[model samples]
Target: MSVLDQDLKTPIRLRSLTWLRAPWLFWGGLLILTWAVSHYAFDIYRALDARWIIRFPATWQPDFESRITAFMDWLLHDAQLFGILFRDVTRAISAVIEAPYDLVVDVLVTGLQQGIGQQAVQILPPLSWVAVIFTVTAVGHYTKSWSMAVLMGLCFTYLAVFGQWESAMLTLASVLIAVPIAAGGGLLLGVLAFRVRWVDRAMRPILDLMQTVPVFAYLVPILFMFGFGPVSALVATIIYAMPPMIRVTIVALRGVPEELAELGRMVGCTRRQQMWKVLVPSAKPMLMVGVNQVIMLTLNMVIIASMIGAGGLGYDVLTALRRLDIGGGVEAGLAIVVLAIALDRLSQAYAGRTVTQKAAQSQGGFAMRHRWSLSIIAVILVTGLIGAAASWLQTYPDALVINTGQIWENAIGYINVNYFDTLDAAKTFLLTWFLLPVRQFFVGIPWPWGLMAMTLIGLRVGGWKLSLLVFVLTGLIVLSGLWDKAMMTVYLCGASVVIASAIGIPLGLLAASNPVSNRIVGAFIDTLQTLPSFVYLIPVVMLFRVGDFSAMIAIVAYALAPAVRYAAHGIRSIDPQIIEAGIVSGCTRGQLMRRIKLPMILPELLLGLNQTIMLALSMLVITALVGTRDLGQEVYIALTRANTGQGIVAGLSVAFIAIIADRLLEAAAKRMRKQMGMA
Candidate 1:
């Protein structure tokens, strides 16, 4: 037999064959060839043949400027009239009712501003950095460990030293307030959905849409309703952050052991009592995971909310990006990362401890002496007292106050003068030679033909239902008068996903093969996933300018995490027995991978594809800032002009697209899993 075949037949000696040709080599080579052809060969040919592509009549650019100006004019006029009428109505009503509650609200507002606000402002000077660090470390240690404690201490110290203490605290305060509200709301909704099948059915689509819809899409309607400020930011954050919690809670609750449910029933428990005493406790781990996810997502939204005047680290990051202040951006980004890690670890530890306690309790008490409940309680009480005392003394001051707006304005001014002029020259070259030509090819395809091709592919992969779903989804986009825009979005997102998969798959393979590489890549994935999506945009825009290419590049960077993670997982999950079988059959390394591994991992690879698509779409609204004409642009305009109806409609359209894609992909994944006997 050949050396490759002989090596594959030897089980124990396979470790030495790390350098042997694997199936990936062939696939990877094919991909490289295809990329070269697509990126260079086709590009060159397309450039040469560009004049031959049929050009459709250009649609009039919507009279956005005039329309927006007129809308604003009318809105201000209406607001003036409404303000006068509201004042007159309130006066008439107040004169008639003269209620004590109205007086109470007025007094409370005045008191809050005068007493609490003044005290907070005055006391801001005495709180020492050492004390703050100590407090954070103590809390972290109490919740988790010495490692976490040290990390937390360092994080706080960095925040204080870097002069972002006040803004950080404000952001923290908002999170502290918003997290509970979101968690409680999510828990309630989740419980309701679990109890009622119809509620679950009703909520499923809404939750899916909420999770997938671009962040900017919600800003328009929310801003219109609430107006722009921290309150509006809070509302948007809550909406965006709550959905994952609700889904997680529902999933966890449903996963409660049936035996436990029966035991609860046998104990003469009412349904409510059983739920509170048994179901919720049983689902604590999952619920906590949900809480952890909620906090992370909420924190993620904080910076984005700053764009609408939420005023926190998000604003700092936004300002930094606008001004190309890499140092400031990195600092703010690091703060966010530290916060995310601390919270994630603490929550995970809490969940694990709870599970351990439950297991220990099942085995009876004395053995569970490791329980540190009292210590935890003591720490909480001590921390609470310290916080209360500090509040009372009004001695805690803000750490840093850096106005980045001027920095941004000056930077933007410079860009307008020099950078854009350079960018415009590049833009002309790219648009004329590259983007326009490719876009024409995509858009020029007959819609019916495109629909048919996609539907058939869906049918082959996922069966008839998915096929119909894909068809309807594409059909709806066409009907919405956004067919071209949707196609462009699809092309950009698709290209990014493909490129991400190309890079990620190999990295995943490499990581899977090496323990050190695996750990490093995994950690990197965590960091990348936690970094706010906008951070990627700044660098991407800097490199590529504000256009489709930059947006696509950003999407690729952001979407790569899941592809790498899932692909690594899939490779690692390959059964040892299967590898043994390949060995016994004297399959070469390449043959083993081709005949066994790739086929076995197809389901998982598709799952990665699904995630890649989802993540790419999530950037829809964010990409608008880079100047791609898509649904995100519509959403942005709606927010800017305070048009709730338009925002909601546009948001729903994006949601529909996500849902359609999700359903189709999920169905395909399910089918593949079943076919592979992995379901």
Candidate 2:
């Protein structure tokens, strides 16, 4: 056998001699010595009050932000392609997008109009709430089951009764237009990437950066380029949400069986025919997963997109939150969650709809095959005629609409007044004992020392190429003069991730071991994952007030799902034959688990850790609104000021941190997999 083949067959634990050649011991000693020296220097700097030793000197930092801003200015105004100004190009693109966007909006919310202002007449009314609810319910029943239809029906009914129908419909209109464009664009790019090897290689890093960069980071540029309105918001939502579908499409297409590809070729099919007719159809099951992800992510962007004038339920929530109208904010937030759940369920059901089921349902006749579609059409016409007579059918009656805002306010007030001391005491205890100290330690470390430590870890995990990548990316943060803020981000994200992992791993273990726990935990995490990151902040901000403590709480809640999910998946994915082998070897349950399962699943746990870190970083950005001073805050401030340069820098700093953490953890997992002979 070749050397690589033989090495792959032999597990690292059985190769004792290999350790003799490794420099890990020397590196470990040097790492400890470097850490001690850095701490000694920190003490000296503290005594002498030399702040520059701990923090990079601002005067020496590069002026990247100004240069970036200048370039953007040129691109927006001065720069031109051929004979056309860039602004004109952008405007032309906007016109194209706006055509369909206006169509959806008019059909759903505004109603079709003719002539100008005073002379304008409504050609048609927007879809009535009754018609909308019926269509959604029928779609659910056709796609999945009676339970799904009922769920969708009740959700829309609640929206109408709660007086949020108009806002909800506006949001739905944006989603309806954005999803097809984003999904189609992503599908095309994914197909291109799959067919061309170099394209796949090129897109990998871009996709990583796109996903890791917080949504807020790119908003300023999009707003600047597209101009602030629903168009800009739609554009931002598309950009933010499109990456996942691309990733999912690439993965799904790559996973298609080679035999299937060969079968197409053997039948004398052209490459295009093979791809579109055979490969895509075979990958449809997985592609549907991508569609579901796209839908959920589009909804998640609603509130964030609203910041740029994409008005809807998101605007309502934002206005309420800014005024500290906690009750109103919670109501709107719940509306978002309800909308998310309804859309998520419908998309998932449609995706899960199989050929057999579809065919079986369609077998009766033309009318029978499309009974739901006909019913939906019938409802719309009936509702439109009735709405003309009794306007309440067109618009829910104001007096009959429910208002739970006062009740929610009263409950929050009761808790605040009665449990003020207890909550404050708990918050103080955590900040004083654990959080503050960790923050101070991270902040006190000299920048070079921190950089060196990370570089060394990268070297150990993945070698010199990884080490250099980590150094350069992190070093740019220092060069950009955002080192302190980056450290603060690291501190907050790291602490939250640690806490989440501690809680999640044990729960995941419990769920994996017990059937009832599995069902309960599985369902809970599924719901939690579907809710937008903003919804988590409302409840947290209410209870904790606003500070690092509150940010940490929100981050933990938003990030906890991934840790739990990955851990359970890892535990459940173990080979049954391995368990049988352990039993046959006369090992007890605990022995079998510790020696075999835990070691075997270590890579998966590492992956879970990686996901936890990524989520914590993303949530940290949203937490900036609550007054945490970190990289997220920098991005947020830049966004508010429309400073593209500053936002991009800070955003990149956050992305770099995430990329470093992700790569290091992935490297560790790879090493573990190699050692376990599973690579």
Query: How many clashes in each structure?
Result: 5, 0
- What TM-score, over all chains together, does every model reach? 0.74, 0.93
Q: Candidate 1 at residue 273, lDDT?
A: 98
For residues 512-561, what per-residue lDDT tens digits would candidate 1 score against the true structure?
87899999998888888888888787656655667788887788788898
Evaluate model 1: give its lDDT.
0.70
lDDT of 2 by residue, 206-320 (tens): 9899999998997989988998999999998888888889998999999999999999999999999999999999999899888888888898899999999899989988888
Model 2 quality (TM-score): 0.93
Q: How many clashes in candidate 2?
A: 0
List the lowest-lDDT window of 10 residues for candidate 2: 13-22
Candidate number of the best lDDT? 2
Q: Candidate 1 at 268: error in angstroms? A: 2.4
lDDT of 2: 0.88
